[model samples]
Target: MWGIEAGSVAQDTASGQYAGLAPSIDSWFLSQSASTASVSKMTAAREAGAVPMVAWSPEGNLTEIKNGQKDAQIISMAKSLAAYGHPFYFRPFAEFNTNWETYSLGRSGNTPQALYGAWRRVFRIFRQYTGSKSLFVWTVGYSGSISPLKTAWPGSDYVNYVGIDAYDWCTSSSWCPGDQYRYKTMLGALRQFDGGRPAILAETATGLQTADKGKWLGAALRTAQADGIRALVWFDEIVPNSNQPDWRLASPSSAQASIQAALKQPNVASPKYRDITTLESYAVSASWAKAIR
Candidate 1:
């Protein structure tokens, strides 16, 4: 489905309302303290005809989670999600390979084993509640300096989808800092890691300051299609008090036009909340999806 991540559900809804094509999934972050509030947000999102994809991040370390210190909280969350009775996504510790996160490898004494164990512990708890329709998305950064992708994977049994969070920092400049500009190749690697599961661009966008953003977005969609990516979620908000570039499509009419045109195509999957059971159903063929949008 065509998804979007923003500061809040209302902000995402407003962006989509102005853009013509509304987002099918509203992606947002969550702390352990915000779990209950996330459930409320999910209800609102469901009523608004969108899925809530929560990036579940704990403020503490993964070692604590691995050791079952967070079991009580995890069980409570699992029960809440099961009661929601709608399909949503649960992405735990996204970009965990990066040092910026407390749960990441090499931080707070977290190892690859600790990350994997923590993920499995959470997954097992959620699975015990049979009514939950939450899909687990294992997301990785475009690049990792600490460990290889395989080292951090919690295994196929623990993962429902493979995802990558990447951005084109300088699509029009040859002198950009960092390696994320090579998102195409990075996405290719993500697909390989997917094995047979569906792949998603969990978060992505180009800087507004860059020229030819429309062209870049168009190309990115086409690349996603070719690489068999089931979904692409744009990171549509500008980060506050940070050097992160503005990725919103609300401005610069040309970029908006490009995405509106690209996303409206029949091949692109629209949100089918009811029939969305598996990857094949979610990633419908052009002939079947033509009437959806």
Candidate 2:
């Protein structure tokens, strides 16, 4: 299955353009604060025939969450998602290995033990309200401090999947100029840490370099299949980094043909409700509107 992290943009702007090339996308990845709007966005994804994979970042004091002070918000989110009544992926404080997140190790007195405890606390809260509807994903970034990746594991009981966010930032520096980083090369460490759980390419994109972006897309999908990566999500936005590559595929570019070809493979699953009629019936039901609200 293929998904997307649409960042801060409108859902249609991201999903619509990709759907134009691929028949469908299996999931829509969304990042959210502790906002009710997240629930609305999840509902919208279902209406568009795509499942939602939400990365919920509290973005506040990690000590508070670790100490159970934020149970109310976590409970509320779990309840809303449970009421939504469909299987969806939920990742809390994703990229715990990276200093960019407030919940990461070595940030504000946080350690691996603290991260583990905090994750278990959040996981327990979600279990109370969501039951099986919420699938917990433990996600990390590939290009960050490495030790936290091992220490932050919240045990197999709490996690249903392991995901890694990686990108091909080909540039003219000594690091990666025109580098065709194979999927396995970037994700090898994370994959080993997965411990037999399903792996997902939670977020990824390629920059324009000397390599053929189209061919690269095809190769990525092929490697993902060969490597037992169960899911993938493309990061479809152009947030600038030190390297000057526009990552957005919303417009026609050199990568379009390869993207289309890759997505059309028989192994790739398109986004469609498991049972659309049932979902529609539930939506019109009185309980549906009240639950989502």
Best by TM-score: 1
Put down candidate 1 lDDT per residue, 156-240, tens digits, no spaces: 7788887788887663445654333355665566555556667788998887454356556666777776776777788988889
Give residue 181's lDDT in candidate 2 (0 to 100): 43
> What lDDT does model 2 reach?
0.63
Tell me, by lDDT, which candidate is best. 1
TM-scores of the candidates in the order shown? 0.85, 0.80
Q: What value does the lDDT take at residue 26 in candidate 1?
A: 79
How do the residues 218-281 of candidate 2 rate in per-residue lDDT, one tens digit apiece?
Answer: 6777777677776667777666565446666543364566566655655554433224344334
TM-score of 1: 0.85
- Positional deviation of 190 in candidate 1, in angstroms? 4.5
Each prediction's Cα lDDT score?
Answer: 0.70, 0.63
